[model samples]
Target: MARYWDDHTVYSQPSAEELRRKAKESASTAKKKGKNYSPIMPKSRRGEICTSWWGQAWCRNLESYADYSSRLDRGKGYVRSGTVIDLQIHDGKVLAKVQGRRRSPYNVEIRIGRLSEENCQKIIDKCSTRIESLEKLVSGEFPEELKEVFTSEGGLFPTVREISFGCSCPDWALMCKHVAAVMYGIGVRFDENPFYFFSLRGIDVDRFIGVALENRVEKMLQNAECKSDRIIDEDISSLFGVI
Candidate 1:
């Protein structure tokens, strides 16, 4: 006879042994806090959007710039004309700034509440991964059924980054107008349906968020174990001092 009823929730939860194994695996390969992830940002028109002095020097070189641009354009989600100004999240508020026009310098500011960490991470991860996966499929040796969707031409990246907006400044620097336009457009999609990015990639954001939450829980368990070990070590040291 069973000692307790295993309802759906209880039965679905991972076994204690499984949970411990997952925590150990995850902690061993956990991402370091300050590791550079190379999160994609829009390239400035002069091709000067690099983060380091070496990158700027490379951008200044025509041969290097051409090669980098070609590779980036081939990659999914490479935008050209507009740049991401800021991404901010605070107590129940999310804010983003995008630049638009040359003459007027159109900018968009978005404020949204009730945005959870899981939801935010899901959006960032899904949108980025979907674009990258499609790009990889296009470049990969394997045959693909949806080759048209990942074509180097008519993709989201160049359109988002390079298209000239209402800003007719004549200066080549990626300024406010283009960024503002992209921001406004993406914001509307987000407002109409929060999972718009996932929809674009043929995924359910809710399901994705659930998986991320499980990963976070595993990380927390590992952290707790480390903390417990430290406490035990301190206690033993104090006892030895008294002896």
Candidate 2:
């Protein structure tokens, strides 16, 4: 019988230097073949890849799941060492390529089910009630209140059960290092473009904002109309001596 991946002891893990060398070699070979490659590099002084609130929230959300937390540390190392060569987010899916010990890079795909219309409308209504929250989101800052909106049950971020992932690697573990690296890379990407998080969930931020603004305007108009009608009623009552 083939030994399981978990059967290998931690002591048998490859050194950081070895991983880095393999990544470089693989990148060079890909370049020779005229393939475009973009790797993720840690920017923080402490080698932390995710600094912004959006990025941290994404990483934290993933770690909250027991199924993924075990391999996240190794994935962090893979991302920091520039092992993820390419990552793309579109239509509720994330696709990536991660270099490992092997010469060929692994392909990773993560799918997050899109929120239902009712759930999205609920979020929009809640966010529209607070103009400050929308402003902070547009400014690339996630306020505490806004964070709560996303972290809430059935909110923006998908629960573990709603997420499906696959990695083209031989590892039998459900969450492999390559998949973890791609996930961390996505967090780093969110640091640069917070809106990508919504895009990954198939939410068009611009369109959502437009709808929210329109709703606000309509409410304002209704309030104004009601005030005008009340003023006219009072004027008519006074003119007819009805008090």
Most lDDT-accurate candidate: 2
In the range 128-199, model 1's lDDT, one tens digit per residue, is 334344344234221233232222233211223332333332333443333333333343323333334333
Tell me the lDDT of model 1 at 168: 36
RMSD (Å) per prediction: 27.2, 5.2
Determine which window of 10 residues in candidate 1 has minimal summed lDDT: 74-83
Q: Rate residue 72 of model 2 by lDDT.
A: 90
lDDT of 2 by residue, 82-193 (tens): 8888788888998888888777789999999998898889888877777777787667666677776678887888898888899998887999989998988888888888
Q: Write down the TM-score of every candidate.
A: 0.23, 0.82
